[model samples]
Target: MSELVIKDLQVSVDTEDGPKEILKGVTLTIASGETHAIMGPNGSGKSTLAYSIAGHPKYTITGGSVTLDGEDVLSMSVDERARAGLFLAMQYPVEVPGVSVANFLRTAKTAIDGEAPKLRTWVKDVNGALDRLNLDSTFSQRSVNEGFSGGEKKRHEIAQLELLDPKVAILDETDSGLDIDALKVVSEGVNRFRGQEGKGVLLITHYTRILRYIEPDRVHVFVDGRVAESGGPELADELEANGYDRFLKAQV
Candidate 1:
């Protein structure tokens, strides 16, 4: 089974003021068959953690280590990390001009798999993935994330998550900007991925509402770049009722 271990992780970002630290000794583990939820307020470094693990150049790893299934994740390039089975669903999925969704998905799949999928089967799979997410088959003809609504962008990310089928998935604010119906639809896609054997999910979100649809095995309260506390599913329920005030105040 695959396991992603983060140990004493520290990260920084470059700004006009020089370097600013974001993640402070953040440590956690996500193993196959477990879904972990990271809940925090804005600027708490939740997204930073996701991006850093995915090898974003914007964030620098000042200290600590991140490993996926015993391999050095931090040392790998962004695309290398994906080929190594680490996937990131960005909070804001960028558009790829002139690249049709079908072509984009096929290229990514080929890159990750080291070969092209069978044409006939690939077409059927793509259509099925789109239909499951409530997207029309014609959606694949559009440029990736180009002129799509926020919900469509997020849904497309999940569709990729299923087709690509990585070992671990890091979703950054995936529930953001989704209406109730879209949230459920997106959540279903995430749940379907989690249902696969040896799949791991690290869902970063601001609200506990998404947790209601996709139950997390562990819930972490992130405050000031560190995980203040971690507990079972009940921890999410507590957060929904109480909020991050207690964790935020503990920092003072």
Candidate 2:
């Protein structure tokens, strides 16, 4: 089974003033068939951890290690990390101005698989993924995330998660900007991916609402760049009831 291990990880970002540390000795492990939820207040470095593991150049790893199934993930390039089966769904998905969604998905699939999928089967697969996400087949012709609503963008990301079939998915605040309906739709798509054998999910969110649909095997409370505490599904319920005030005080 695949496992994503993070050991004492430290990360920094280059701000105009100087380098600012975001993730401080953050460590956690996500194994196959497990879903982990990271819950924290804003500016707690939740997204930083996701981007760092996904090889974003904006964040620099100052210490510790990140490994995927015993391979050095910290050493891989951005695309290399994706091909290595690590996927990051950003809090804010960026726009690809001129590229059609169809072409982008196919190109990414080809890159990850090392060969293009046959046109006939690929077409059917793409359409099926889109339909499952409640997206119209015509959506394939539009520019990726360009002019699409926020819900559409998130749905598209899940569609990618399904077709690309990565070993692990790191989703940063995917529940944000989604209404009740959109949230359920997106959560369902993620649940479907988690159903696959040996798949792992690292869902970073500020709210516990989405957890109702996709229950986490573990819930981590992130505070001031570190995981303040971790527990089972009940920990999420605790966060929902008690909020992060206790964790914030402990950090102080």
Candidate 3:
């Protein structure tokens, strides 16, 4: 029964010139077991919306409110947001040279759960998640995302999504650099998460390919810092055929 509500969200970024607005009056809702895909052209502020919801410091919420099950998200810090069951899989997953993947995942899980999972169970869970993503057992011993390929990094993100089991997941282009096989594996991981009783997915992507596999219950079109239109899964097909030209034309 988790519900994530975003109402009239207005966000801006600080630049050398001045403050530049990114998201404008964006409103949407994602409830448990619903997958919402946000499709838009480049520079349309798709990632900005994801980062804003994830409480990234670079973007400031100039207006509106976001809530998770009636709790104010704006007041929560980045870590607070995670502990509050909000997860963001970045478009570019960063690396940590010294942090083993196992250690990092356990630390993050402990932070969110307020207690460390039993080592035996946690190790089994970690290995299982990694195996599902087509990663080897040795991967857990490697430093997080260090020297991994692009597809591997994205798969690692999905593995986190599965292991963390958050209430709401805001994925910023999880399909960006994956091959067909890797894409399917990652999609399976997301689908696995969606199978849970209390989970929602906010999938931000430019292409409809991933949508074919993940199957969004709703699709929203973003253009020029605002949500231009929203509809069912059919809207993603419309974007594939007609493209954003029509939406951009409407803006002009």
| Per-residue accuracy of model 2 over 12-48 as CA lDDT, tens digit each | 9999999999999988999889999999999999999
lDDT, candidate 2, at 188? 94
lDDT of each: 0.96, 0.95, 0.94
Whichever of 1 and 2 has more lDDT, that candidate is: 1
Q: Which stretches of candidate 2 lie above 4 Å from their native place?
A: none
Model 3 scores a TM of 0.99
Candidate 3 on 1-252: residue-level lDDT in tens?
789999999999999999998888999999778999999999999999999998989999999999999999999999999999999999999999999999999999999899999999999999999999999999999999999999999999999998888999999999998899999999999999998897899999999999989999999999999899999999999999999999999999
Candidate 1 — which residues are off by over 4 angstroms? none
Model 1 lDDT, residue 94, Cα? 97
Ten-residue segment with the worst summed lDDT in candidate 1?
243-252
Score every model by TM-score: 0.99, 0.99, 0.99
Scored by Cα lDDT, where does model 1 land?
A: 0.96
Candidate 1: how many backbone clashes?
0
Arranged by lDDT with the best first, the candidates are: 1, 2, 3
